[model samples]
Target: MELTAVHEHVWVIRGAVNMGLVRTQGDGLVAVDTGLDKQAGKTLEKAAKEIGLPLRAIVNTHAHADHFGGNAYLLSRTPVTVYAPEGEAAVIRRPMFEPEYLWQGASPLPQLQNKFLLAQASPVHVEYTPGVPFEVDGTTFLPVALPGHAAAQCGILVHDVCFAADAYFDPPVVDKHGVPYMVDYLATCRSADSLRSVQAAWFVPGHGEPARRPDAVIDYLKQRHEQAFQTVLAACRHPRSLDELLADVCRARNLAPANPGAYVLLRTPIAAYVTAAVGQGRMEIIMDGGKLQFLTIEK
Candidate 1:
């Protein structure tokens, strides 16, 4: 585990995915997101020991396994108050857990599979409000709602550095692939644009190194998003179907089809981009025998 101090009270813990620890003015600490599997508990424990503080609160940015899988374990160790996005909180409290909806065909992390399968979805103790201030251990964190990544995803701003959850990707994912999967592609763009306006000393992404300028990441996302849209436009010239579009996207990107789940997740943004273009009169979608086909607008 590695720790990168972004501000006087905030630190980013890097492992399989980045987790955050913030020192409150009073006592205790607030953890944003959790690492993958049981390792997250270990990582948080190590971080707390190193920093010499007790955990006071835990905030889950979303309901992804890697982000929230460690909740059961971490809560078992510390008496912490937990908060999650309202949409995500519903999933966490559902009576019958369904992994297929969230992660189809993907194997659960060894340490967390049982808890996720058997645990009851409980009501959210605390709900998130965009740009609303919440206090933890005497430190106030502004929870800014960032949708598109997930319906109720949020980002945290402590003074200047924004802990931008999974709204943006890093490393092998975005750095290498140059694209990200967002349920609402256009909304994702708007969210990134809003984040870019925040003049912060640093921004800590969910997956990459702490960034000093949000503009760089926003610019990268915009460029890749447009490129992907163009690729979709070009591929749809022949009235290609969704599956066909997926195939072409994978082919053009050199992605393996063996991982259809991953491919679908990655292609979701392309699907959204195409859908958006069609809605805005920039492209046309024709229904042929129950299948939709796309065509770019001329002009």
Candidate 2:
């Protein structure tokens, strides 16, 4: 809701989910990722107007509802082209796919159909290419792939500031969530490495304050990632079903999925850890009495 200038032309609208704005030639501006819903989109539009920067385009870093939910509202108010990564474009256009995909291709339960999972549909006019610079009126935004938070998720770089969209979480936020959500554990690590390699004057995370020394943040996230993986590994000392594993991990971490919705959401990142463990040959899947289970690999 507050616009803090990161550079002369680059500003970040600090909110629960940070949105970026880059002033371009003339009165035009490029918005990088909207907030959680139509209300958030309206706030962004008003904020831009207060600063005399009219929106010209929208760049969605990924398809997560919280990141792109404001797209529909913004597009409805102005004629702006939307740019999104290829793999995420479909979900942005068909927001329901998010919950459905999370439910394993089955009809999502009512709890899974909330605004956090399903956003209103919006048109995507451009498919972003990672590691390439996307030129707006007179500014260039370098789209850096930062997947694992979501497939094809990316960060936008402009005016010496990098808008890292959920590639990593703020330390306190990570502690608050207990286990940060990730779809691919290895990819998350790679994204952290990618962020570390970027030479920028400042780095802005989707959910935290912008930092001049992003390495410190990245290092903390790396430690958390390793810890979460180890927690899952220890939870799998004996054969356990996915649900059982999830419960044990949550119990050890003092995390309680208070509702069905929370349970489904928390299941995702834990499942990702299981997938990564199996892929790395540290865990094995077995069938026991018609039940699928995961177990630690015997030495």
Best by TM-score: 2
Per-residue C-alpha lDDT of model 1 across residues 219-239, encoded as one tens digit per residue: 777777778878888887788
Task: Identify the candidate with maximal lDDT.
Answer: 2
Task: Write model 2 residue lDDT over 28-99, tens digit each, in one string.
Answer: 888889989999899889888977978999999999999999999998898998999879899999999999
Global CA lDDT computed for model 1: 0.73
Candidate 1 lDDT at 216 equals 69
Q: How well does candidate 2 score on lDDT at residue 232?
A: 88
RMSD of 1: 3.7
| Cα misplacement distance, residue 143 of candidate 2 (Å) | 0.8
